[model samples]
Target: MFDFVRRHNRILQFILLLLIVPSFVVFGIQGYNKYSEGRNHVARVDGQDISQSDWDAAHRNQVERMRAQMPGVDVKMFDTPEIRQRVLEDLVRERVVFAAARDLHLSPTEERLDRLFKTDPQFAGLRNPDGSVRKELLAAQGMNSALFAQRLSQDLAMRQVLSAIGLSAFAPESVARAAVDAFYQRREIRVQRFDAREQLGRVQVGDADLQAYYDDPRNAARFQAPESVTMEYLVLDLPAVERGISVPEDDLRKYYGENASRYEQPQERRASHILVKAEAGGPADARARAKARAEALLAEVKKNPAGFADLARKNSDDPGSAAKGGDLDWFSRGAMVKSFEEAVFALKKGEISGVVESDFGYHVIQLTDVRGGERRGFESVRAEIEAEVRKSLAQKRFAETAEQFTNLVEQEDSLKPVAERLHLTLRRVEGFTRGFQPKEAKAEDAAVLASPKLAELVFQSETLAGKHNSQATEIGASQMVAVHVSAHQPARKQALADVREAVKAAVTQARAAQAARTEGEARLAQWKARAPDAASLPAAVTLSRARSQDLPKALVDAVLKAPAEKLPAWVGVDLGGDGYAVVMIEKVLPADVADTGPIDKVRQQYAAMWAGAESEAYLAALRKRYKVEITGKAKAAEEPAGAASK
Candidate 1:
């Protein structure tokens, strides 16, 4: 066989090529095309496509970040199409700014990056005393020092691009003054109000008017009942699971024993120290001098323990505590540097210690007080232990239970079967609408209904038409809900007989308001033709945007907007159901220039407005320059939670 194969090597190679090339052509090209189609580009920036998967990942990251920050908040509140669109826009903006930075050679220098990390308060937790990156802190955020530095540098460069436009904004004194003067300009006006309530007795509305009002197409929505459903749902949440879980007394005790330290309050020490100014890693001479100075303070404290505070106040280099007699107050383990903690813990109450060296400097320590370091007994924390154990068990069991719950809900036609199988409560709610919160709903039910996902599932065509169990929807972390809509009521206009009283009230109010407006207009005309005596009108009051003088906004607006160039101007304002007003503009007054504070504030506001506008314009220009295109069709705007169901 070996001899034969060696003889046919060339022919075998040709045969292998024929087979391999065909497979590559047949399968590999199709696989490549499928991969390309899977990308599903939704946006493009600087000719770089942003695929749907990328957008989803970015939005998921943002949602998770927000969830971590505010665990108690409902994730559904921010997980909307609008919020996702904003995230995509932000991603596009970031890409555009990054491209601009690269093109303009605006990369931040190493020195600037280091300076920012050390000086910026936001990064204080991520820096060591010597201004080095805290690798552990970065690791907690799922990034290494290198990655953090890269991100920080990029952010700084992008900020520089926007800051250039923002900082260049300036509002000249003249421009600022004109705007401020116009905004604050006051008008002295006398208003005569025709209260609708007073005119209600005079206005007449009968059955005919009520019927007409109810029959009007424009008023149909007012008499219509919103679409609603009566649903029975099964909630499989961590809390519900925990409620059913019962931890044995022995198990609780075992958990308590295993985690005894958690129930034990750590010992806290209150101490004062005279800190000498010198870095531990400073020159040998400086460190030595700091140690000597601390030793001298320690000796003085030993000689006169009562006068230690006075000496600390006078000589301590720690400015934070220098004025307060060098008091560091109460601190537990892991709160202070290792050397300082060790030194403080070693001391007896009211005992003074020799010089201790730490990252900041050397310190002469004195322990003034000690507290805590107590372990709670079994009976004292038994309830707490049981709750903890139950919650832990529920968390572990939730995934499996959730799977079963989902499967059972889908396999079965109703939620009752799943509820029974999972030993969960089958709760029922009547008149549950898509976005409406029942006035008498419990807190738990309200929170459940607040989930747009759950509402959407309940109103889905299949679920509504078939009256079957909806899919298990995740309303929150570790919270799944499956609802069965038992009864659905479509929206319909109420019969005129059913809504007669409401229609009658509406007609009466409309007639009264109109009557008031008519009288006000007639009075305004008469007052304009011949100026009424000052005694007949209400006392003149100054009005401005800043000060409404207890007048209705409509009246104030009408008074201020009337031909104020001519004094004693007359204007009529309809105040809706409240009534109407005839305002007499007595005089026009310029802004108070005497108050420099207001003028300065106006200038600052103007500058801020100008800067914001400039920044937005610049961003628009950048978008144009990058040829940014968003191809994703925006989802229809969703009604907010607790809004009208219709």
Candidate 2:
């Protein structure tokens, strides 16, 4: 958290813009409805509605993140009440932070935000090679400068509030030491098998027991199906539309002649530098020393220009380039820091600079190579021009035809007229649930089936009761899908007759597990009372905390944490669904911790963790102070009072 928060802090102070490394994922929310009045909202925070569209975007992003981490994760992993609740809780927490920032009257000036946009390396990916930020790029990234500043200011304000709240937070040295020891400590134990399978005959789970357990209303949800929708949507496939669009030979030739700069290459410059590293926020004396060292090196390079590479190899602080004699390779303008780029670009081929100052410190730079800009011939870029012209004509045709498609769909009784007019297919998908994500990463079919917002158009009160056409929904920039419900499958609980066998098996397994635990406890008690014997008590195997994979994880955890006043200590643990284990702790080995070095870093980490906890508590208090009404079925765990209690 500390590393991420302070990563881009050299010559920039806004940790909020850098993004707080929260305990859970915080998805980027788009289509923010500032005047979220009477909208379909999953949650209402501080009288501001978090619109359903924004929530869906955030939820999809969370799912994408999970999929990225666990490539082979089953669809059922996210088909739970817990994942939904967690996403809502994170959004609510963010809202709480924003509200707190507002109440505290915290806001930064526009000048500061604009300055950050220009200087921050975090936005480097969003910028062009010319060091300019375009409006088109901003919109493509789903962040306009105004909206970014608005959201970023609140985040910065939240950062201020958190820092203030956590000023007094600190973790004791003892606590840190104890935690380290507990983590590194190891123990070993040999297990005596008391298999639940062997004890299964003891559990006589009759039909009456199974029926009684299944009859309970509390178990009804375990047998219930999640809410799902089966939709019939008419798609205006973009690829299909583009294929139908024809490009004339004359248009392609004209396009190439007009947009000649698209095929032109920019001038490139390559330079190498021996760097003297110094942190911008560090002591001035250190910065001065680093600059002086860079100057001396610059003098030496100027005195013997032929031995520049040798000097860089021996003296450069940049590890990435030092081994290659400070070779940065080829780069264009705006590739380096403003000062370094300007100095390098200004120099002629083989020219060397005296010294240059940047956020990283001082640099003794030498220009190695320069390539002049040139434009490609029309013949060379003819194919590229043809493709662009084709797309341009296709988009223009799509824009004009989309409106007509929408009007026809709305006026006509059925989709046949629109399908006939557009020569497109009217497809129907059954059992379309939000949980139906695609196995393939690049598959496009799942997005259509899993869109809850569009599915709502078919499943809502009016649409479900009667057959009606939905509004033309834009699937992408060049495609629109209009959907209608053909059939409905309302969520219902599983009938007892259907789940009778399942209930019986569950009851039998549970009974067997309980019986095994009870019998193991009794046998362990008898063994502890008498002298240690091979037939009754097995000799303890030596194990350490680091390597305890041979034994059951539950048993290993019990042994490691088990208090030991004597040579052997025993503790019984019920390993859920796997019967019980009686772990005998034979030896306790703790980690050797010193007052300094790694221990000091551990102390700092603990303090930061404590501070984070304090900030969470403060945010919880703010949530209670505000009237936050969440419309969905998630618990109010983000509430100030509930959060504090937790």
Q: Model 2: clashing residue pairs?
A: 186-544, 186-545, 187-543, 187-544, 187-545, 188-543, 620-640
Residue 67 local lDDT, model 1 = 63
lDDT of 2 by residue, 1-646 (tens): 2443244333122222234222112432232234456788888887778777656555666675566456676544664567777777777777777667667787778787767667888766445577565445445335676655666665567677677868777778899878767676755454565667776676787778978888888877777654555666677756657666667778777888788778789988888899999997899999999999999998899899889889999999999999898889999887888999999988998999978998999999999998867988888888777777767777777877788878987887667677788877777676654355545423556676566445545555555543667777775556688876666666677777888888877787788788888887987797578525544556667665556667777777777777777756667878766788776666776663432238778888778878888887877788888777777764322321111111
TM-score of 2: 0.51
Please give, for residues 1-646, the per-residue lDDT of candidate 1 as tens digits.
4554455444333322222221221112223234324466888878776777767766766665566556677776777788889978877777677678778888789998889889977666456799897665445445577766666666567778889989888888899998888877888888889988888888889888888888788998899887788888888899888887898888888988999999888899999999998975689998888888888888889899999899999999999998989999999999999999999999999999988888999899889999999999999999988888889999999999898888999999988778777788888888777676767778987788777777777777677765578888898889999988888777678788888888988999999999998899999889889998988888888788888878787777777667777777888899999888988888888876643247667789889988999999999999999999999754745644323334
Q: Candidate 1, clashing residue pairs?
A: none
Task: Please report, in order, the local distance difference test score of every candidate based on alpha carbons.
Answer: 0.79, 0.70
Candidate 2 at residue 452, lDDT? 47
Off by over 4 Å in 2: 1-186, 193-210, 246-390, 437-442, 475-477, 531-561, 592-597, 606-646
